[model samples]
Target chain A: MKNNKNTVDPFENEPDFLAQFDKKTPFSVPDHYFESLPEVINDKILKKKSLKFGFDKMSYRILGPSAALIALFFVVFHFYNTPSGNTVQPEEFSDALLNEVSVELDDYMIYDVYAEIIEETESSTEQTSGNETENDEYIDYLLENDIDINTIIEEL
Target chain B: MEHYSDDQLLSMFAARESANYAFNLIVRKYQERLYWHIRRMVIDHDDADDVLQNTFIKAWKGLDNFKNESQLYTWLYRIATNETITFLNKKRKRFLISFHDVEGELTGSLEQDHHFSGKEIELKLQKAILTLPEKQRLVFNMKYYDDMKYEDMSQILNTSVGALKASYHHAVKKIEEYFKNH
Candidate 1:
């Protein structure tokens, strides 16, 4: 009950109206609720920050190395298998190459290879012999006809 | 820990060096007022505590973006009000309760809660206040308890000043009727 002796209610038709009601709530709290609230709230803020920082550290420490390891594997695999720098090359066909391939070829095929080589040399020789002989014969006939050297130089 | 004006506090807060100090001051200064504001709506100390903490955390996170147009006090009040309303609405939804059921649940809280020491009439007053719509009750609490201005209430609720005045007026009449009969 309120000490309404010194007060008057605005709506006073009824002897006891609500305007005289004291507005103070009678709420209580557990001991030290307010005293500890700041620390409690600050602690929550700190926990959130630390969790975020921990995640960042975990990413840097763990995922960073994991990513590096994957990149290194790719680089090493690429270097070892790439065909440009370290691959072996043959300057010319070798007896070793011929022997290596001969097992896959037939006996006629080997003979055909030698025959083709022989035919190519014979054709080359025939082409050169005709040209040499024709040039020498023409020069000898000119000399036997006894043409003057100065006249030959001037007219021939 | 001497008293500093809101502007001094804000200017100190603007610098990264003194920001934490400024925030602490801000929290200490307004925590009690904001707590009671939320508590009246939610009707539970524990819920008020959670909502209050959330309100401050949000304020701290967004402090840099707080424009100086409105008073910081009203800004915080707005945040606290929204948080309380959201919490109450979610509480109803999470429990799958209707508005009346939620009211019954809150009314029930008055007895079960060890912290609530409201006398019979005060308890009755709370119950009567609860009978009004949530928004009307809110308007009533701010106007009756906090003596908040209609203009400030308008800014907080994003309602027109005329509407808030109307809401407060209806809320008062309902509570008066509740008292007259009971």
Candidate 2:
């Protein structure tokens, strides 16, 4: 290697002097240190995950029982649903939602629900063939029941 | 086990199920290289260990944001280098000392540490290298000791290759002068 007149090539010009520095270190690690590091790092990851998910926070831990108690309250209220004609009771609101989203139902659940509705409608239709009576019955029934008539009609 | 490419290892890391496994492989593969990279700077086993651990932990946290803009090794080397520099900076601040003061302390540590069994000449080279400014010492270590290319050092240091070449050139001249004068 030709060194420029003003420059010194310490590493290049030495007779294999640089060989000592290659991947060799005087630093020491504790015995089996590398073997244990993965576990240590994984533990750190687990802690990070817990923190990220808010699992370690009081809010999340409180959420578990509070959410359950709220659910229980709703379940108890549903069986004893209130009779409010104008205001939407929670139970009625939930039923309406379930019915709307039930559009994803398979053949059996839909058939079971529609079979009962159709039978009652057919039996009642025998009383009046005029559009006025049928329309009035369906619309009034739906309005009083707090059901969205359009949603059921669209689903069908 | 078959060796996985950097991309393949990264994909494995992306998966939650295999992330730990891939990380273990990564640690095993890169730990020694990173340790020495750090050890050369800190010159003490305990300090090097701390710096190396912090480097990997930081790398683990930053892995998601890694865009493969450079080689995986270079990214890791960059992290390790930065961590070493940060460790040294903290020591300097805490001790209320200058960069040269820190270098002098390191020189004392090197002589006293029982683990360093290098010959007097090797020790002289280390001290000479240490006398350079921290940035030049880093450049010299990577280029001279690691035999790293100027391009790779540029990626790791975020400096231009031309600048790295110049830095290496100047570092060598200083070290050679140290050897002659000492």
Candidate 3:
């Protein structure tokens, strides 16, 4: 309470010139500023409140769905991209397709396909054997005529 | 309009039904005093109006958290004072100017302000007060113009009474020196 005396008489040492000035503020306002301020302030408050509410609502309406859609997209992508035991991989797909074709074929159709494959294999072997015999005959002819084998091979 | 005590107003505001009504009453009661307080800090009436509106808006938002620890008037005053200071600081920051330069700008604007109806001496006194630091100016205004108690100012400013007195003393001496020089 050391300054209590000073606090009680704050203007005790005020200069005469300073004391002569009235306490009235130098500033003024537009007509009836106070009369309408409460309403103006209330309107502003309401506006601010609604603006905040609108932001929250917009988040729910837009951002919420956007987030959900992004999550769904990731989930779907992960579901398709990740290899699961029940899902067919690229390597397994061809085997699966062949198995499916085989299962779909009738007994007669399967027998026909197997027969055709066997016939093609036998023909290919016969052609190879014939080629080997021809090559042996050409070399024998070359030896019998005492022709230069290297020159005969080059001519052949 | 009927006058309601601060307790009555607080209790009315506590209820959802009468909250708006109570707030309107509170605004009506304190708007002029708060306006002048803000107007003095910010020389422009428009700026003061904006600051006052902001102060009330903040009060509306924060009143729920108010624990009635201090007087409602003082609490509202604190909000007004803070809003004014913030407005001034933002002006300074926006222009990238120092505090003293911002005050100089205010002084310049004061001359051009149509809302300023004060005589030449009053304007000179205002300019002299503007030379002090922000806190000293506030103390000087509160003490010299409003004659607010140092105790109430302590709660509003969150500063010690001794410091406030010293600030007021320094502000007075400085203003006197400024007048003597000019």
Candidate 4:
């Protein structure tokens, strides 16, 4: 059998249409560009984080004093508005008047006159009882004590 | 065996007075991902570096206020997206360019950058993407490049899943057309 194989030089017969595009423009990054990037970034981030953390800690510390001052202010405000225990009641009007009069009338004659009037008022109420015999027993007790009946009657 | 989730790390960082471990762990985990994401958006390495630093700093400060409604990565993504957009908006203002015009400028710059590998291919793709509106480009990046599901993307972008799907499909058709033409 005769050898009838055809041979072709792949690079020879082609047009140079893509020759300009075949020239490679290499992309070169700086040496250790990405390798040192992490450390640089870490340093920057560390500095930023420290400044932020410092400010936050300062604010946190300030919160304690701020809260204390607010609580103290509220306590003082409450105390200033609260009423004292010694305020007089409406039902004690007559008692107040009597106490005032007693304080003003400290003389022995005034005291004697008030005491005689009270004694006469008590005897008159006793005499109005339904039984005359009970009134007689009260009169007997007053007589035995030698009480001043005219003085008490004059006062009444 | 006791690997901490992002939420747990954040909570530990917030609650403890000395949580360098937690904070450092977060930095180690997310730095490259965030860096690349911001780099793609901003189109400048130095700008991406600044934005990445600001992002992590903001994350550390705002960690306590983060509710666990979304995953921690998604929350961070939302922040990063907002930051990148805001930075671009400011840059646009400074250059007196509209957002679409800014994307055109970025595409031109990226196409000419010598350090980008597969520059021609990536430029073709980026130019095609630049033809899209801002929101559509963002959607395409998240879906096509990042392979983010619509659910996670919805949480990050605050857009409806249906709208994202439409945006992504439109972006794909536009890119396909560009490829066919070029």
What is the TM-score ranking, best to worst?
3, 1, 2, 4
Which pairs of residues collide in model 1? none
Q: What DockQ would you assign to candidate 2?
A: 0.15
Q: Please, what are the lDDT tens digits per residue for candidate 1 over residues B1-182? A: 68888888899999989987888888888888898889888888989999999998889877899999989999999999999988988998999999767877887887677887878888888888888888898888887778787889889999988788788767778878988888
Docking class of 2: incorrect
Give me the displacement of residue B128 in model 4, in angstroms: 1.7
Error of 4 at A146 (Å): 94
Candidate number with greatest TM-score: 3
Query: Please, what is the whole-model Cα lDDT of each candidate in the order they appear?
Result: 0.76, 0.76, 0.82, 0.68
Docking category for candidate 3? Answer: acceptable
Position A78, candidate 4: lDDT: 94
The 10 consecutive residues of candidate 2 chain B with the worst lDDT sum are: B113-122
Off by over 4 Å in 2: A1-23, A26-30, A51-156
lDDT string for model 4 (A51-146, tens) is 989888877898778988999999999997765565333224225444543223223333344444445666766655544454455556555665
**Model 1 alpha-carbon drift over 4 Å, by segment:** A1-18, A56-156
Model 3: how far is A116 from its true place, Å? 33
Q: Return the interface RMSD of model 1.
A: 3.8
Q: Per-residue alpha-carbon lDDT of model 3 for A35-99, expressed as tens digits?
A: 98999999988899899999999999998999999999999999988887654443353354445
